[model samples]
Target: MCAKNILWIMCDQLRFDYLSCAGHPYLQTPNIDALANRGVRFSRAYVQSPICGPSRMSFYTGRYVRSHGSTWNGVPLRVGEPTLGDHLSEIGVRTALIGKTHMRADTEGMARLGIDPESLIGVQVAQCGFEPYERDDGLHPDGPYAPDPAYDDYLRDRGFGGSNPWEQWANSAQGEDGDILSGWLLAHADKPARVPEAHSETAYMTNRAMAFIREAKADGRPWCAHLSYIKPHWPYIVPAPYHDMYGANQVVPVVRSGREKENPHPLYASYMEERFSRVFARPGVRERVIPAYMGLIRQIDDHVGRLAAFLEEEGLTDSTMIVFTSDHGDYLGDHWLGEKELFHEVSVKIPLIVVDPSRDADATRGTVTDALVEAIDLAPTFLDAFGGKAKPHVLEGRSLLPLLRGSPDWTRRAVISEYDYSQRRARVDHDVPVADCRMTMVFDGRWKLVHVEGMRPMLYDLESDPEEFVDLGDDPACEAERARLLGLMFAWARNPANRITMSEEQIAAAYDTELDANILIGYWDEAEVDAARKARGDAE
Candidate 1:
């Protein structure tokens, strides 16, 4: 039989709890719900890192950020790293990327990191293995302000002028919302530009992906396509039909009473709550934002629905495998944060679903598995499906096919996530440079240990405190368990060698410099030096 077509859909900055299938009542994710009903849902799948680049690096390389070295947004993915696309393409599968590929930021860090000035107009695409057909060069949320130059002239008419542009705009009543005149006009209920354009971001992405699928199908070859959507990432703006999905009152807020003293990260105490509160503060904002987010989700769900419908219509549904997940998650008023990269449940835990259409009735379908899976496992899983062996070069992930087959011994006790030194540095004051520090997290089924800054570590008993507002790291009683977790962490760090061999480009760029130093100082260099000296003495 021909290899099955693979479709991987990645939603940017999406919280796991926002799905109706995930028990979110206010969010309407009917398409996702339907997908879940037809497949298996991983209830405890977590991203390897909470940030965009690291998590995506984990996804494509099947290695943790520390091992892959694409830890920060600006850093490139070592060009030669064996990616899902590289492997799949090698085995007769055409791979295509569409929309919001944040995996690597080349060319002055513009295309992948969303930092280019042209990005303001939405035209920035084409990095991270994608070829874009249409790109939205101007879709920011704090947008869509009045277009009439007379409006500003009216402000001038009303005797409102200041020293600076923002100061002039924020003249007591007006604000610094990012929306310009064209965007503002579009935001109006009765505007022509509000109509969905053939080149709007979502529509363009969906259209191109469909075209790619059709072409690949016609070529009679298997294909792997990554349809990544930039919705709901930030500047939280959704187009119409999505804009009015819910009432503000109906949007549920993350519930946390008094702040706890457990987490010592500066962001935990100072910034998190304020961000959440700000989003919730605006009148009807929740209703506006939640439904917008849901609508955007539904929009993607619509794409998924269309793709699925096409598969079935073309007699390919049963011959394709569909995997849906996200790169980390958004704050969306949960814990009062907005964008992700935090260690909170809403930020780190993502929705992971896998549908194997060729599975037997007895195979795991519509099942919710609790195995501690991480994004790194995805590459190996895809490779496994294509009759490829997962080479062990620096790949710390395991295949899920055995788990899917219900092998009794197939179990992963823990999954690990490591933050880059740069992001951890962002958490503290400049005076306390965290460059020398590395954080490693290990979570078993019920317990989590966070070793940060080489200081006293943190332990959370999720069974007791699901919110993770309390840290049990200081408890003397949990010492044995703590030691065991530490042992596991050290063992992972001490892994002699991993297999998924890298290309020369990847080896130089993605290899963790810091981790390599530790290994050289503590492991390989001493043995090599001794061998060299002994050879010299023997010659003498």
Candidate 2:
């Protein structure tokens, strides 16, 4: 009744609607679609944060960004925060990382506690509690950012010689004049990457995952392989064949309008004026960039087919749970935005397909649910699949196993996401203080409200404006709805997120035993104390 292994596959910046199963008009992801046909696909899954580091930290820790305090990129997850690896490993599962987690070590926290970084406990804390088969964040530019030595060695061994082979060979493209074109420039997006298809980053990560699986099988240990891929993200140039698989004609319609910019929210207008947004809003930017983005996704699908086939060949398919998701979705010019920093559907919503091979999951196979799921839910789901109960005081997310097994009692009223933009240019442009550069979005099934610090809250009636074109933030007509959502946000913010040391049951038990411990402050007489003891069956 429990899965012997878990294969957690997470892609970088993949949108919810990009797969064939998810209603993409032109792009086809047959392998991912097949996975969906074999399991449950959540149609409305949102991450706790839209940014990479905070969102991934939420996914790893099963807690909100505010609770984890890793609110932005390069911010370290505090040393003692329990992650997926930490929880799974406690139950005798080997947790291994094959690729990116975007986790920085809280070295200061460790040093303050006098924990040696080279020690076993410190190593686990530094690596986000996963044994690194290979930990590569996948961005290996020259100069300040050092290339991943292992990936660089792999590239060089394959005869791609350069100071930074990952940047020069894997991410760059050859121009018409045979000049090396950096993938950093959006102009070269339509061209194929200089590296061969097999030597690409996606392929390398896939091979590493398979290698880890094979080793785990030989060792005969139940393992959770976090096969995280770093593609379909930036530097969006795929290898040949895949590069030109989709033309400019295949690109979906841009989901923005001039009306959105007419009287945008102050924060939204500031984001629209940012360089990336302005560049994406240009005449032919999306046409050039989106096809390559689609191509990268197609390549990932192909690799997924390869991985699934490998699992079956190794006789692990029937015992392993395959989970496919992403850190967050990309904006790609939606709402005049180039990146994922806002509360738009295109940015916060991500693809989540779970292929549980257990017999209990068969009834829900090939079904799509409109359940309100969050990124934090995955950690508890994995633990639940392994017959482990989620620690309610520690994990904020409920397990998805009941939903997977067709339990009817599963119900959720709202989902919440947070954003901290203190380090962003918008904060500086608006002259906002660091403490005031935060936003919280609370969405019921029909209405979405964003509470921005030091500003008017943004509201959208998704039932009326599914595209979120109209801002009802300052509209007096929607005052009642806005107030209701504000109340919900306030209640959510008031939750006791830090009360992790004791569960409600434990607290209740402690209260019940307080009088038994003879600390009776309200006792007026000895007869009353005797009656209380007799009632509690503690009379002597």
Candidate 3:
């Protein structure tokens, strides 16, 4: 079959279990559910890092957080790291970014390399290798950080006048007394945003994606369009009809337990005491905020349906692969945590649905697999779809094409994720040195172990305590399991991931080729070298 176009849709801060197809109780997401029915849904997909920037870097580079070295938000992805666009573009596919990536350019690295930021090559490098159609990270606050001027201009042309229209009209809600309530505050989450449904961030992003696809079709090139939505994130308010669609009664039950706060891990305790966590853990907080979160998701679902219809109308449905996923998930008060810094399933686990249009994927269609998949796998998956072999020396993730084609040999013993908390308040409260403010998690389908630097490692027996309500970090009974998981984590760390300059085949061939090139290090004499040559039939 010929290579097909790719439509990569990623949502910000969307949970794994919030979709109707994922068994969510009341959240009706028919459009996303349709994609799940037409594709393979990975039930146990995890992100490389629970945080946005690092997790997205993993998705773009097909490498781990540590491998990419962009450990947190605002950390620049090093200039030379090959990205998904770089890989796909090499094979003549048009790669474009229409929304959020949270990518910070490595300006210092670029200066050191003498690459001008405004140059054509440098612009591509700064954008993590994609040709940016409209790059907006979507956190357009008024002060300190510059607002997204493009979005602001669009809103102004439509008559929303303000110094910061995004924060004023789009993200704020109207109070009963005719006051503006900022959506950044959780109390205003129940109110509808001032912007109309058609001009909200989610809708605007979907329109931009459709526009990119139209231009790509006109140009007659196979394209990989990354349509990233910046919704269902914080400042959790949706516009118009969506905000009122769900109420406190529709909110799912919070997944936290009081026992978790009793003598919790020092790191976990610090996170629980954080402002966001404490506020979300309040008696009626989830009921107030989650409905709005769900509403944002519902808006996204509607837009997905619209985009799908557009594809069918354009006669591109059969020639495009749709990948629906998220960078990471929101805790929504799970484990007494509000944000996604921990390795709990609610925070690290995300939804992944792949609708490959190829006939070879028919067997796995409409099926759900419990395979341990990572966010990094997507970069290589896109590459494989474009008729490119994964460059194993650079791309750490294995291609999922084999599994999509019904190959049963795809099995993984453990999946790993990392977190760097050097910039978080938890590190400061715990007095952890910058070098030691890190953690790694290893999950082997049954047991989950988190190794925190310079602290007791947390362990969970998912088979017995699937909710992860109890931690066995200090429990003497689980020493063996902890040790085994540590060994696996250590083995994974010991891998020479930076040795990317040579392929495995080149390394194997170097053994004999070096001697043939007269760079013999262990040769005893000319006669010994002659014997070796004759043994290899080189003298014949």
lDDT of 2 at 235: 87
- Per-candidate clash tally: 22, 0, 0
lDDT of model 3 at position 457: 97
Per-model CA lDDT versus the true structure: 0.64, 0.91, 0.89
TM-score of each: 0.75, 0.96, 0.96
lDDT by residue (175-254, candidate 3, tens digit) is: 88978899999988988999998988888888999999999999998999999888888889889898889989988777
Q: Per-residue lDDT tens digits of candidate 2, residues 1-540?
A: 999999999999999999999999999999999999999999999999998899999999999988999999988999889899989998999999998888889989999999998898998898889998888887775432124548889999999988888889989999778899999899999999999999999999999999999999999989999998988889878899898999999888989888898878989999998888888999999999999999999999999999999999999999999999999998888899898889999999999999888999889999999999999999999999998866878888988888888988888888999999898787988899998899999999889999999999999999999999999999999999999998988888899489887778888877767686788888899999988888878544
lDDT value for model 1: 0.64
Per lDDT, the best of the predicted structures is: 2
Model 3 pairs whose backbones collide: none
Which portions of model 2 miss their true places by more than 4 Å? 141-147, 514-535, 538-540
The TM-score of predicted model 2 comes to: 0.96
Off by over 4 Å in 1: 105-199, 261-267, 270-288, 421-430, 496-540
For each candidate in turn, give its C-alpha RMSD to the true structure in angstroms: 10.4, 2.0, 1.9
